[model samples]
Target: MPADDGERGAAALAQMRAMTADICDVIPLTAEDDFRITTATMMIGNALLVDSRVTDLEYDRTPAHIARGGLDHFHVTLCIEGEMWFSSGRRDVMVRAGDICLLDMGPPNRTVLRGGGGRTHLRAIILQRAMLAPRLAHPDAATAILLPAQHPHARLLANHFAALMLPPAPEAGSAEVTIEAIADIAAAAAGGTADIAAGVERAERHLYLAVIKRRIADNLETDALTVDELCRHFQISRATLYRLFETDGGLAHYVREQRLNLAFRQLISPAARETRLIDMAVNMRFSSDSTFIRAFRRKFGLTPGELRELADRWLRETGAVPAIDTVLHQLARRRKS
Candidate 1:
């Protein structure tokens, strides 16, 4: 049973934004604009089925929003009417009527929805990260990707989610089973095993590693971003943390590399020139400027000043375009290895 808000127009948009923010942080395009919106949501066990119809709008989860707290869930959206475009990191996908899309809420994502002279209607099933963790490997890889409704497993999951949103929804016990089934099907569609017991331990390990890396990236600017703090936050033993990053030259090395890379980006940015090197180092929790510079030079074969000079020369010669795709690809490869 979808619970609809009685408010109309702008008020309805405001209500929708508030309700959505409760589930996950989003900057709703309709929040400040005049838009006709009608929305409803129903909870089935740990899953939330959202039904929405609104004017042209977009929802953005910015880096700042992700720094605050990323959404710990995945959205399986089934387009009922109109179309929507979803973008995250290096992937961009558009889904139309009868199409299905998977969106990982943990990453910075943007969704542009258009009404096409009428309200754009959609049904989205939001699944908690824990629910899908056991069945899928590298679940984040499935994010911002489209699963055409025609695919066998995708069709199955889509039909199941649609059925769950219908009147006289499944009983509590049945809903649990249905939700598990949906996850299993989604896992198979995502190139994971359908059997939960098969490779589940490895899947869980991957999920934990992914979560830890995301947490570390989000808190890189804070002085509290240490291995010990991560252990406490994730309730894992120190040995486990070391084991997780052993292939990446240990946890400390990984964090240092990330911080250095962040600083390198900041150094190359024209707007960041006003930010002092020592201040940036302190913000990144580096003990001192000398230590930070040494680490940065060791990683990139050049000091921060040298890199910034090279960046400026390149920008002057060819404009300020960065090879973003190359960077993303390198990051993806690093994550995989």
Candidate 2:
């Protein structure tokens, strides 16, 4: 049966916490406002399909949380609407509508869904690691990346998730096939073998792109980083480099976005308060302070100074973190609008 926060009224948050305690820790970012969430789960064989619509929320899997919640499965989340920022220690990627991302349950990671709008709808298929591990060439390099939902294999998975919500749902036997297809697509996306032979090639290409991205991040601060340098370093042709980053608006755009994101984080750090804005810009390899400020505002809806002030205010107000039980209990007692 699907558990839901609807009709729980003041008890919604606690109910939500109870429902997901074994999966991940859910924290409402805008605790000052009503936290809304609706979830439906369907079991197919050994896998689970979870469809959820949520407002502003942050899902965290810290070492402490993982100790309490066993991590034995993986979640391949398909974004049906809205966007989320997902970060594993090594990478940060935005998953938006028509995008799919792999979240390794074993890793300590975080996902932030922005608010101030309608709920974000997502379909997460959870399967045990053993289900896909054997098929992967590099299983350890599989998580924290986005795969285009429009791709043939990914499209099949997306279509299946959509069909699961329609009237007169798939039969039990057919549901099993759907589950298999989802697993195959996920495996292929994560550099694993699948029923489709072409998936092997696609998986290798995806893995290659992951390596390229890591290399780019390593040299982001270098002013001379360019497509030519990347090609030489990776021993790949320029065409391959362009194709790999085409979805991100080319390598240059992706690099700039990454640099800007890093600068934004640094600007809000307590220790970075005394650092000059120009110094931050230069460190990111931005040509000038004005250019960096313009790019920052375009990427994050705020100037560096505004973000710093907001972070300071937020830190002062939040002080010490309360226990999860305490927070949920308080939230459960609050009246809902």
Candidate 3:
């Protein structure tokens, strides 16, 4: 659900502008404006809090309340509780209560709202360049595209964002976290490269990527493992593959780290207490013990033998243990230990 007109909606839009370093507008279609465009213009700058913006503009010439402007950020508009028509370049679009529209700020665009003899509320989110640049290298390249509001995940995220925009801000720390997660979710949902997981909760964008990470972790033991192999198996583009791992660390970095974590767990576990380090390396697909030692040292500032010794000491210090404490834990447990 999107916003309904009231002080709450107005305040939320105001707060959004203050918190996010950009401006947002919440407009309600008025009957008097029907058959007459109130305003239409182009937008500029970085807007990411909602959807993509592009450098194009068009209208149906079907007189109505119109909104088009230049914004220094990404602009997202949801035609909640009304009927609306839009033209982006040559493409004409119709928006209903559940249909959300994305406008590129750097491009010229126009929108017309046809009211059903009732007030129509629309929510627009404008995000700054500083806010979106880190997540995407070329954000503008994705501008001027309208993500269908029918997408379940996109609707879920849009609804959540709308809810957040309708309320007063929470405590500062919580609000900050919520805002970042909202941006990440919006970006992921609108990216349109893959499907968002089923049963996704509010503000858990990172959790979706965790699935990809776990997949990589599970396959680390294969001697021929590489990002290309993982990407192929997952059917994701190189950029998406890299983006999924970016928050965890970097893809190559995480692969090496998980491999080392597995090795460390294997070295001290009772099931592998007598397994030769060289053999362990071979089984773990380390091409050479020296290479393994170098990576281990670089990661943990200690040699493999030293880490194993430390793990043994830790195990001895803590008498109780799981059946498969390290590498086995990964295979058997669905969640991180």
Q: Which candidate is the best by TM-score?
A: 2
**What lDDT would candidate 3 get against the real structure?**
0.52
- Write model 1 residue lDDT over 1-337, tens digit each, in one string: 5556534565666677777673434444444555766668888888988888777778877777677774778888888888999998998899988788777888788888876776678888889988876567677787866778665445545555555665432111255656665565556556564465464444444444555665566677986667788877666789888887887788888788888878877877777867888898898788999998898877766677776676677678878644534434544575578
Instruction: Write the candidate numbers in order of decreasing lDDT.
Output: 2, 1, 3
Q: After superposition, how far is residue 22 of candidate 1 from its true place, in Å?
A: 7.5
Candidate 1 vs candidate 2, lDDT winner: 2
lDDT of 2: 0.71
How far residue 58's Cα lies from its native spot in candidate 2, in Å, is 0.4
- TM for every model, in the order presented, reads 0.51, 0.53, 0.37
Error of 2 at 130 (Å): 1.5
Q: For candidate 3, lDDT tens digit of each residue in 240-270?
A: 6677667658878777777887886676566
Ranking by TM-score: 2, 1, 3
Against the true structure, whose lDDT is highest? 2
Q: How close is candidate 1 to the true structure, as a TM-score?
A: 0.51
Q: For model 2, how many clashes?
A: 0
